[model samples]
Structures are given as structure tokens and as C-alpha cells.
Target: MLMGSCKSLKKVNTVSIRTTKPRKISPEAQNLYKRLQETTKKGYAFGHQDATAYGIGWKNDGTLFKTDVHEITGQHPAVHGFDIGHLELEWEYNLDTVPFALIQDQIKKIHQKGGIVTVSWHASNPISGEDSWNRRGKPIKKLLPGRRLHRTYKTWLATIASFFNDIKDDQGRPIPIIFRPFHEMNKPWFWWGKGKCSADEYKMLWRETVDLLTHEFSVDQLLFAYSPDAFDNREAYLEYYPGDDVVDILGMDLYQHWTAKSFSKNLNDGLKVIAQLGKEKQKLYALTESGLEKVRISDWWTKVIDQQLAHSGITWALFWRNARKSHHFVSYPGHKSATDFMHLAQKDYVLFLDDIVPIEVSSEAQ
Candidate 1:
């Protein structure tokens, strides 16, 4: 009895250290950090943005869309290694068979294979409002914005926090899930985006959502991100800017297969904006979402991005679809590619995993 009591008392008085507590770094993270150094100089001169240079990863539509998970993961040729991973939850994807609770198990699967998980948390969408946007299911359009239905946002958010609350990496530390919400808000349509709410409303929603998750739910594990769609002009970028405090990284979703000139223009415009933003705000920039429409065609897979790699602002770029031809998400629905497409085989692009880290136990949240 005295030994047990003494041990318990010692536990209460002892200061915990990372040395005593095992710090198991995931192999994916280990390689990613290694690649970060290998791919760049010690100083900040960006390189010719080769897609393969930095990091490579893919987004899995979580539901078990492919019953044979092995067939999908690592089998795709476009995604090779060390890119950040995403276990996205959309009505079109997995969330049907497995509940949100089981997501960590699958994330573990990805991590075991050496990859980081980017948790896809849709902000407000037409089918689901903020209040109704948790992993449960989408809400009706009419029930969004203001009123009791909106309050459901808190309930659902709490549910999500409780769900991810216990998730840990291989080392038992919380998995560094980059929670990207309201991505591409500049795209006027999506619920939590331009069409549904005014800029002020959007900012308020963001602030409120961050407050709810960061404060109320105690989701200290999340790395808050804002990814806007690639813009034709730089104005759209400014339109959705959530300011310095809220956004962690700047990114865009684009397809190099779209028309070489136009696509190049948009991406360059984005790079310029990022350069300016990075200079002023001190933030890291990335082509968060990217892809070529056709599997066998074009250097766009690398040309568009690495062209600006030598610049200090841009860090990483992750392709949209896997190497598989059928599951190609290159150009959304109805946007077909021309037959006999030209392919750029020696693609080089960077996946800047080393640029912005997710967290460092930021003062233990609130």
C-alpha cells in the first residue's frame, strides 16, 4: 500500500518530458522532413517547381468506394510518395459504410504506409449549412444560415471534436490533421462560400467556426487552412483573404490540362499574389490542389508549378486525381479533354511538406 501510494505521489510530482515519453516520428513525416532539406538550399531561393521534388499525396473519397483498398492506395501512378494525404468525407465518397469514429483507424492505415492525413471538413455547402456540416450527413439548403437550425452547427461540431478527440499518431501524439474547411470559398457556389454568405458574413462564420472548434470543442489538433479556387484575376484572392491570424496556408485547385495559356495565366497570377502575400503576411503558399486532365498528357503536371519554384513564396503542390485514368478528377464533370493529348513525361513539382508545420502544441489550446 505504501509503495503504490508513493508511486502515485511521484507521478503527480514528476515533470513529463518528451525524452521520457516516447516520440515516435512517422516514417512519412521523417522522409518528408528529409526531402524538404534535400529539395532546397538552406536559404530561401525557390527551385524550378518540379512536382516530384517536394512531396506527393492523394485524396481518398473515404467510403470504401473501392472495396479493395489495396487497389487504390499506392497503386495510382500519379501519386508516388511523401505528399500530404487526405481522407476526405463527402456524400459522394465513403462516410456511408464507416462512421467518423472509424476514420482514425483508416488514417492509421495511411500513416502506417507513410503519409500524412488531411482531414476534409467541408465548411458550409448548399446541401449542408454550417450547423448541419458535421460528418453525420448534409442538411437541407432551407435550414441554413440563421435560426435554430444554425445552432445545430455547434452540436455537430462538438460531435466531430469528440470523434477526433482521441486520435493519435503511431507515437500516441495527436495526428496532425490539416483541417481544410470552406476550401475554394472564392468559387461563388459552395455553401460556406461566396454565393451563400456575404464577405462579412463569411468572415463572421469563419471566426465563429474557428471559435467554436478551437474554443468550445477543444479541437486543438486541427491545423486551420483556407484554400481558394485558382482565380482568373488576383481580385478573387483578396476577396476571400481571412487575414493573417486565421489562415495557416494559401492554396488553389487547378488543372494544367485546361488550355495551356489560360491555365498558365491563372497559376502565375496566383503565384504573384502568393509572393506578395508571403512578403507582407509572412505565410507559406502552395498549390494545395492541382492535376492534369488526361493521364498520358502534358508537362503541366510540373511545368505550371515548378516554373515559380525558385521564388520564396510557393512551397508544395498536390495533384487532384490518382494516376488511374477512370477516377480522373482532372477537370470536373463535362469538361472533356481533347483526344490524342500531348503528354509531358518528365514532370517536376514540389510538395512543400517542410514549409508550414501543423502544430507545436500551441500553448495547449484554450
Candidate 2:
């Protein structure tokens, strides 16, 4: 579905392209990256992390959501989000947690069915053994080079690297994943955030993690994403950036933080910085995580979300999981915003699972 020439501009899936050859990413990732670059300008894909196993009306209950996306909007999300934190720690799989076995199955299905997969890690603090938000003191330093917990951290990476390695398709070729770690690093809530580590220290931590996963562990079917919280300007966004070599995707996580007027302005301003910087560095950009709790605003999907996306040039925007009734991002069937959400889903520029081209894996790889 890719066509055109350099002089007239390249086209993929009938859309104009602006893709760069990836140096460190896998061929599968490179393929998706190119499509995303072209798709953002021509159309934006809708992503909802953990859309099948759970949602607002459900929570890993025995009954799974069946054709609900089609029931609500006649399509499935283009991207599915999953987490491997608990799996890395060897925890049992449950409603709120994921198991390595189940994760691989889910990813394999996504690839086979012509959808994308993005994974995030909410790793616990190695030092304190607390949750990701444990801000006891400089926990990140322990995980860096020559630190007290460095060995343990390496073991942890080995576990994660194994999971990444284990994900394979029917043809046996490794499936590509948009691996986002230490997300919202600019925020102070997480242990790896600005308040817990220096800019240079954070960069080292990021590089070390990538090095361990890519080189030491020899896991290659991954695209690294460096994402931070919302910022007012480019300086703040790039303050703790690792570097161009270690990052393939420039992503931002922003939630509703102001009145309609100021929220849109702040979001657009931050997006402008990311979009411009991503272009300069020849990297893909995405709204890694977004949405208002409960989706109170009736037209939030179209007016608030889609309006900013219209000009942001982001490859995709993924709303957080629909955990339960009280805390949710996407509207379920019968919700007040259900109709509006479908409207956002049905936009001409909005691409869902049915809109994307299916991935083809060679039988030799099996």
C-alpha cells in the first residue's frame, strides 16, 4: 500500500509519508514507524490500552467484552496497551495484573489481526521495594551504574528482556512492541522522576536500561519511547531527555489540567514542541497517555481531544485503561459520552484496527 517518489513525496496506504530509516529499531518496528509517520499526517490511529480484557463496565471478570467496540463504533482500536510490571516481578496474573503467557497470546493476536501493541512498565522501586510512586529518596541512583542495587536491577531487566524475547507470531518472527518505560519522568510522583534524579543521572539510567535490553540481552524487536509529563515549553520537555540514539519515539502524557480554554492552549503548546523536536530528530511522536476521569465533559472526545489531535501531528493517542466504573477514560455502552466517543472513532482521519494493513510474517521464520 506504499507508493510515490521522493520528488513528488512518498505515500503509504494512500497517505503522504515522512518516514526515516530506523537505525536501532527492528525491521518490524521500522515498518510500523514508517506507517505511523505517514498516518499521523493523513490519519490518526485510535489506541486504548487493555481494551479487551477490561473496561469501565468490566474488570477482568469472567465475561470479556465481545464486539463492544463494533457495537459502539463499528470498529476495534488500532492499538492495544498492556503492562509487564508485575510479570517482571514474577507476580501471579489477575484482573489488574498480566501474566507473561497471557501477554504473549494477546500480542500475537494483535499482530495477526492487523493491530498495534504498546507496552508500559510500572516497575517498583528496587531499593524500597515499594510501588513505582515510592519517593523515599534517590531510589533511581541505586539502579544506575555502580550503585548498590545495580545487580538486582540488571536481573530485573533480564526478566523483562526475556518477556520481550518471548513474544512471537505464528511464523516465529518476533513481534514489535513500542516499549515505553519510566514514563512521565518529568513528573515528581514517580521514583524515576525529576525530583528523584538529576538530568545526567536520568539519562544514564535510560541509556543503561536500553543497553542492557538491546545489547547485553540481545532483544531487538523493540522501539524505545521516551515520554514525559506535560510541559509548558521545549526546554522543560527536553530537560532530562536521554538522547536521540536511545529513543525512537518522542511521546508525551498529558491529562486534563485546566479549563477548556487553557487546557487546549497548554496541550497544543506542548505538542508543538514535541512535533517540531520529533521532526528535527526524525523521530515518531505520540500522545502516549491521555483522558479525563469519568469523561465528564459531554463533547470531550471531539472538542477537547480531536481538536488538539487535528494539528498536533502525533502518530497515535492512547487513552488510559478503563479500570472500573468510578475511574475510566473511554466511554462504555450507554454512557453519556458514548455517542461522542463513537463520533471521534468514526472521523475520516481516525484509523482503527480495520483501517490498518495487516502484518505479514514469513513462514520460514516459524
Q: Which candidate has the top score in lDDT? A: 2
Q: Mind giving the per-residue lDDT tens digits that candidate 2 earns over 1-366?
A: 111111223433432222222234566666766666666766778888787766645444433433345558978888888887765567767236645566677778778888889999888777677778888878777877677988988888898888888888787878888999999988889888878887767777776787788778877778888889889788999987866766878899988856777778878988899989987887778889988888888899999988999766788888887777788888889888999988888787888887876423342211
Relative to the true structure, candidate 2 has a C-alpha RMSD (angstroms) of 8.2
Q: Can you give the lDDT of residue 155 in candidate 1?
A: 64
Best candidate according to TM-score: 2
Off by over 4 Å in 2: 1-24, 59-68, 358-366
Clashes of each: 24, 1
Estimate every model's Cα lDDT from 0 to 1.
0.44, 0.76
Give me the runs in candidate 1 sitting further than 4 Å from their true place. 1-102, 109-114, 123-146, 232-235, 296-298, 302-313, 329-366
Give the range of the ten consecutive residues with the poorest summed lDDT in model 1. 1-10
Cα RMSD to native, each candidate?
12.8, 8.2
